[model samples]
Target: MKAGDRIRTVLLAGGSGTRLWPLSRRHCPKQFIRLLDETLFQQAYRRARLHSSPDEIVIVTGSAYEFLVKNQIEELGEEVLHDQVLLEPCGRNTLPAIAWGMRRFADDPDHPVVVYPTDHLIGDGMAPVVLQSVPLAEECLVTFGVVPDRPHTGYGYIKPGDALQNGYRVAAFHEKPDSASAEQHIRDGALWNAGIFLMTPRLFFEECQKYAPEIAEASLPGEYSLLPSISVDYGLLERSGRVAVVPLTVPWSDLGTFAALHDASRQDQFNNVGDAHLFDTSGCTFIHPEGKRVAAVGVSDLVVIDTDDALLVCSSGATERVREVVEELDALHDPTVLEHRLVYRPWGSYLVLEESRFFKIKRITVKPGASLSLQQHHHRSEHWVVVSGCANVWIDGETRLLPQGESTFVRAGAVHRLENRGQIPLEMIEVQIGEYLAEDDIVRFDDRYGR
Candidate 1:
């Protein structure tokens, strides 16, 4: 009962979607990826802000992503508490995630909690719809379904059985189907499951007790790894006869693949999306940073994703098969597909500019008022050069503030750390030289993040 005190919103931020890979990986998933106006997780927070206060929102993410969630929330102009974002020791899918997210709302049984997957992309200003459906949620588990403009084979389908007070009884829930099956499902008056549910702790636990008692009674973060992984659609929604679906006429997309991202975004006359110029190519999507021009002269119906470490060029129809490539690479233990070149840390982030056997170069950025842990490396010595802002460096027993253009050297086995005391981000160039340069070589004395 320590999490969702006076809460109304539960935003699920778990899952590592591989369909948009090269950009999405194990540590950083699609929810945290920068899309249209902002990252999908930020967009979900913006949407959640419509119905609840910052303190009332509960974000559930993996233990490794706690800093990411904190950094993002701080960027949104509000400091987040450690409890606001629940940490999952391991993933147990939606059934356990939702049940655990609803655990701390025991003070108020009928307190309406709207659950949303942070990876979804929905148009803004849809809070009034959830507010209007509160009465229905009090009676039965209310799930939102979007009216599909076309037969979308990627999403699950929901069939409306009979009309309820403000919604309809869920007749049947079908998993993702083939193109032909998807068309038939749409023609039979089925709606695309939006993966958004609104219910209370009372209703949710009651249904879980009857259907999935293991999920209903398990303690999360400790017992989460022991539970079986299953989605809510199969474990609860399809089995519960009291479930209802509310049809929403809004632009909602999971953006599970690059093609879906292109479909949801604004395109050009040639049906191209992102900062890309097409000479003969049409119906393609390119994802890259600005100032980096990506041109396709003689290609068509392809998706080009350019990153610092990896590039993916495949047919637009082959977007769904991106996971296969990731799986193949993962089976080979290819390190290129795990994390991005820009690795996020508790303080800020660091980008590996170049690396070799005996030496490595990095560009580190510490956010304003953030500091690295006091630690020492046994196998490497580091040289820090202040590039943009002020850096408060502590080496051995001496401490000094190095402004821009100043530099310092830290010998191997010396206790040191970097801090940003200025209002702006601290930018520095680090050159590391030694016999071995691996992350595990560091020995921490103290860490604010409890790493």
Candidate 2:
């Protein structure tokens, strides 16, 4: 915008959601997973485009997911600029994340910044309604509230005080209520805090100064770790008197849990979603996205999720307990809960086909013009066979260009690197022979990805 346009969008894609895990993990978040034709992050980007220009939208994610964010945006056929994506060093809740976004307008503190959590499943039509409320953001901290369709205990509630410009003043803010409190809030005309906000940095910082001075002072990413991890709701919105709530009449779901995903997704007459051969299953959600067929019999209101390495089966409405399951897995130090068999990197991705005590096999793909770190393993020697495309291999001081069906070997303690210089992706199968065949056995002499 030229000066005084008063609108910029911030997309919070750094969040790791385990509620829809196996598909959504620490390495691959909910925003990157494709439950439909497009990912939820892409949907949020499209919604942002309806109101602001591509230049006006700022994407905030962690350093680990930087490539996932960029690659997915490119898959949409649009090139994302390097400066457009902000890499937060760590997860410190929405308060610091929002502060990180609004800080972009240090000189233009009066400019309104609209924030959206990318995990939300919002309909396309809601963009126009959001555009209509941009003017209200100048004077009040605007929060887009979803009118409660049902008594959902997971979300925080907001009670409207009085009528404002096409919205209402926030009378009270309620924390995540229980079953009884949620029903009472629903009956009292409270809105579910959709976690969407529109406000200028001036107003936001002023509220932060009053409510959370440490957060206000700790604006830079390096100082972000020092601030207490808190949501914008607890730190600012509830205490700020200059807050307003706009009822979002759009079809929306936070998609925070598998049960919510099932509710929002398309279902058959039996109310079933996903790949499953069912005989007597109704209101059960089974996800077999890998094209594997699963059989279900005489089960209702159950959630059966099957990934290559993990399977989750639980009651439908009790999907919130998946977090507890994750905690238990973490307590056991199981790596399966953190990532899938396939892990994404800036260059491409690698899938572990098989692993044993003495041997491991992996299928690795390198994007064109991308290269892995110049590194070597201490306890393992790797044999690489090119399956397709061309590979530029560097072992020790020797470098050679290998084509499809060619093979190469890198002895243990020898510096080696793999690069794809061809137009197509270089696909290769790697077999490792070692006593300790672990990922941490690598010692990088050099890396372009800053690992």
lDDT of each: 0.88, 0.87
Local accuracy of candidate 1 as per-residue lDDT tens digits, 1-451: 2122333898999888888889898888889978677899988898888778887788988998988888888778887965898988888789888888888676788888999999999886457778777878888899998988998888899999889876899999988989999999999899999999999899999999999998888876678888889988899888998899988887888999998889999989989887866798788888885699777797778888888888999999899999999999999998766789899998999999999999999999999999999999999999999999999999998999999999999999999989999999999999999999877899999998899
What value of lDDT does candidate 2 attain over all alpha carbons? 0.87
- Native-to-model Cα distance after best TM-score fit, residue 186 in candidate 1, in Å: 1.0
Model 1: lDDT equals 0.88
Once superposed on the true structure, which residue ranges of model 1 sit more than 4 Å away at CA? 1-7
Query: Model 1 compared with the native: what TM-score?
Result: 0.96
lDDT of 2 by residue, 262-369 (tens): 998889899998777889889998887565768889989998888888889999978998988888888998988778888888889999999999999999999999
Could you tell me every candidate's TM-score relative to the true structure? 0.96, 0.96
In candidate 2, residue 246 scores what lDDT? 94
